[model samples]
Target: MSEIRKIIEDLRKNKAGMRGILAIIIIFAYGILGSYFIMGLNINNSIYYTVITVATVGYGDIIPVTPLQKLFSTSLALTGLGLLAYIFTIIINSFEENLHDIRSGRHMEKRLAEMENHYILCGFGRVGTAVYEELMKRNQKVIIIEKNDEKLEDIEEDDNVIALHANATEDKTLKKLNIDKSLGVIVTTGSDVDNLFIVLTTRELYEDAWIISRASKKESIKRLKNAGANKVISPEVSGGNDIYFAAVQPNLVHITQNHGIDFLEREFEILKKHNCHLENIEYHFPGIRTPVTRTIGVLDEEEKDHFIDMVKNNPEVKESLDVMYNSVNGVHSHWISGPDKTHVDMAIEELKKEGNLLGINLDFKEINEFTKQFKE
Candidate 1:
C-alpha cells in the first residue's frame, strides 16, 4: 500500500512533465476554438484540423485563409508539434522503463522457483548483512526478503543473492520463496515484533526449517523461540560475552577468535561437498543434556563391506558394531560410540587416521545415549 502511494506521489510531483502536458492540452483546445471562431469552420471540422495540425500532417484541404486564422494556425502548429514530440518521448521512455521492470520481475520469479535448499534472510540491516556476508564466504545460497528498496540495491550485482522487495511478515511472501524447499530462515529485522512475526510465518510454512532470529531485548528471546525460532541471538549479549571472555578466558577467546571451527556447520559443509544431502545425515550437537553424535554418510555395498573389513581387525572397536542405513538414499553407514568425551575423542582421532584407508568416514562424534542403546 505504501509503495503504491509513493508511486502515485512521485507521478504527481513531476512538475515539469505535468506542466508540459497541461500546455499541450490548452494548445489543442485553442486550436479547435480559434479555427471554429475565425475560419468559420464547424466543431467537427475544427477538431479535424486541430488533429492534423498537431500531428504535422497538413493535407492542404484546410488551409488558413484569414490573417487572424493563419497566425493562429501557425502558432498552434509549432507549439502543438513540439509538445506532441515531448509527450511521445515521455511515453516511449515510460514504456521502456516498465518493460524493463517486468522483465526483471519475471526473471526473479523464475530464479525463486528454481532455488532449493537455499536460506531465506528476512531483513538487510546490519545484523542481516553480517549474516549474509558470512554465508557468502561459505558459498551458501541465500535469498533476501527486505521491504526497503535501498537495502536490496546493495546486492543488485551479486549473482549468488536473490533479493525480494516485500514484507517478510507476510506468509504469501514466504510461500513465494518456497519455504518448504529452503534449508532454513534467518529473521534479523530491526524490530523484534517483525522478526517474531517472520519466524512464526516461516515456521508455519516449514516445520523442520532451522529458524534463527535476532532479538533486541532479553524478553524478546523467549517470545521469538515460542514463535518457532530454533535459535535466537542478540548482538548485545554476544558482544558483552566476547568482552568478558577476552578478560577472563584470554586463551580460549584467542582460539575462538582465530580458529573458530563451528564443528556442526563445518560437518554439513563437508558432507555437502561429498554430494551428501542434509536429509540423509542425522546429527546432534553436544550439550549439557544431549551428546555430540553425528552420522556422517551412507555407503554402497562395496564401500560398506570394505569399511567393515578395515575396522573389524581393530581391537578398540566393537566386534558386532551397528551400521545405520538411509532408506531414502539406499546407502549404509557405520556407527561408533564412546562411554565419555575423552574416550569419544580418542576413538574419533584413531578412526580418522584410518578413515581414508577404509574408504569411509569415521570422524563423527559419539552419542552417549546411542552408545547405551547399542550395548543393550
Candidate 2:
C-alpha cells in the first residue's frame, strides 16, 4: 500500500515518470519471446496469443500444448494483464492530475525562476488584453497575472505566453512572477483599488522598476501615483483624447498610431517632406537649467565693490555647504541647482574671510517633471 501511494504521488508530480511504462514494455517483450520459444509457436502466433491472453480474451485456437507451454501461458497472462491494468489506471489518473495542475496554474512556478527582464502585466480585462497585444507585437517577454480563468483563456492560445491565474494584488503572487528583475510592469485591472494596491506592492518589492498603471476612475490617477506608480494613466482621459484627436486631427492621429514613431522620428519625417532640415535631437533629462536671475544682492552699497574685488577671482569657493550639483568637472553629480538657495548663507559666512560662491547649480535628473512638461 505504501509503495502504491508513493507511485501515485510520483505520477501526480511528474506524469509518466514511474517505472510502470518501462516495466510494461519489458514485460511485453518477455511475454512475446517466452511464448514464441516455450510454446513452440511462430512469431506472429506468439504475438497474437500473448496479446489476447494479456487482454483476458484467450482464444481456444491458440491453446498451449504441454506442461512447459501451459506454465509459460499462465505466467505470461497473470503478469502482463495485471501490469497493463495497473499502469493504465495510474496513467489515466496522472493525466487528470496534470490537467488539474495546468488549469490551476501550478505548472507555471518552475518557469518563472528562469525569467529576467520580463514584463509583468497584472490583469486580463479588456484594457489588459490591449496592453498584452501591444507587448506581444513588440515581441516582449510578458507574464500575465489574472484571477479569472476565463479572462486568461485567450492568452493560452499564444504558446509563448506564461500566465499565472492568481490575484495580482498579493505579494506572494508578485514574488512568484519574479517582479524584482522585471523590466517593467503594467497594471490594467478593472478595479482601481486593486490596481493601486498592486502598484504599491510592486514598488515595495522593486523600488526603481518602471510601472504603468491604469486608473479606472479619474480620481484614482493621483492616488495611484502617490502610491508609487511611475505613470498613472486614466484610460477614460486617454481614450477621450485619442477619440478627440482622431476626429479633429485625423492626420495627427494617423501619425501617432505608428508607435515606432512615438519618439522624434515622426516629426523628422514630416518636416523632411516639405524640404525642412532637422538638426540632431538630443534628449536632456532633468534639463539644462538656466541660472538663477538673482544670486548676489547687497543692501550695503558701501562694501559692494570691496566684496566684489575680494570674491571676483575666487568665485568658485570650496567651503560652500554640501549640495547636489552636476560634476562635469570633478564635482559630485548630486548637485541641485538654484544657487539662490545657499548664496545668502555662504555670503554671510564669506564676510568673515575669503570670497563667496557666486552660485552655479548642479545635476538635475533627466526627464524631471519640470523638464518633461515645460519644453522650450
lDDT of 1 at 316: 45
Stretches > 4 Å off in candidate 2: 1-107, 156-160, 239-376
Q: Rate the local accuracy (lDDT) of all candidates.
A: 0.60, 0.57
Candidate 2 per-residue C-alpha lDDT over 105-207 given as tens digits, one digit per residue, 9 for 90 to 100: 6446667877765677888877777677655533446788889988776565333468777899888888887777666778888999899899898888888
**lDDT for each residue of candidate 1 in 165-192, tens digit (9 for 90 to 100):** 9999887788888777666677888899
In Å, residue 145's CA in model 2 sits off its true spot by 1.1
Count backbone clashes in candidate 1: 0
Candidate 1 clashing pairs?
none
TM-score of each: 0.59, 0.41
Off by over 4 Å in 1: 1-17, 36-49, 57-62, 156-159, 239-376
